[model samples]
Target: MSAVPLEAVVIGASAGAMEALSALLPALPQNFRLPVFVVVHLPPDRKSLFAEIFQAKCRVPVREAEDKEPIRAGTVYFAPPNYHLLIETGRSIALSSDEPVLYSRPAIDVLFESAADAYGPALAGIILSGANEDGARGLKAVAAAGGVTMIQRPDEAQAPDMPLAALAACPQAHILPVAGIAAFLQAL
Candidate 1:
């Protein structure tokens, strides 16, 4: 069992996210109690079908996060295409149109940092395959806040830059392959 009593799990990815998530999300046990938030880079002008696609595959509830929506355990929330998703002090979702970070509107850094503040030591942040360095600092913030941090092993990632950047920024982050990450979450 995990020592942290994780209240939330935050995941960030870019280029190769869909496949990685396909391997990860469907594996969570149906009774898993922690809320999960995900940020995956995508074109802002397009509509997102992430919720529908993942919901069809996952045993747990999956939906696109809405502004002011209450954060609920046992559900997985995905940031919409253009909005930067945040967790407010009241534990409600906040969507922003603020200037994009790292050339991405739904930046992973935004979600991970906000969650690190909201959940503190009870949060777990995971950085996966991507071509950019967007999530590195946010993962560091999670670790600094005493939350658990993880990175998909670089060599195993479909695009290793994001994981490598995260590993460089937060050397202590647990390094796991995608399947290993799923197992770890199940164990938690």
Candidate 2:
């Protein structure tokens, strides 16, 4: 049985993400509470140090995703810089030079949409500070799948375009500040 109340968490960040992730990560207990998947836009062909950096600060194990890996609790899964990370029973990390949807390869929408299909009501999708409007439709899919959804308050975002786009897509989404977001996850 999972120690965390929720079955899964899917978080997406881009612009101003490092700071936002720093704030949110430590808020969870060292043992953490659930399976957390994150997609942060990064340039292809670059060696992303994000997983290493985050693993240091977090109590839970963290790694760049590998295709066909089974989901486990208390672990953080990050999309590789170039691949679109997706959950389909097995967490799939697929690399493609294909055109960027909404201009991102490790696109937030792709992750959330696949996760919605895989985990459905067990998922919680979070949209954080970002430059592009990548996560909105994915977050919408999460809601349609009976999952919980949250968007950072556009006003509080470093680049409000992402969260604002999410709001425009799913007006019923819970808009929250940075501090309240972790607590909201805890409540779930």
Best by TM-score: 1
Candidate 1 lDDT tens digits, 87-181: 98678899999999999989999999999899888889999999999999999989999999999999989999999999999999999999999
Stretches of candidate 2 above 4 Å error?
A: 1-5, 90-98
My TM-score estimates for the predictions, one after another, are: 0.97, 0.91
User: What's the lDDT of the predicted structure labeled candidate 2?
Assistant: 0.83
Residue-level lDDT of model 2, residues 7-78, one tens digit each, is 889999999888888877657676666788899999888999999998898777888888777777778888
Candidate 1 deviant stretches above 4 angstroms = 1-3
Residue pairs in collision within model 1: none
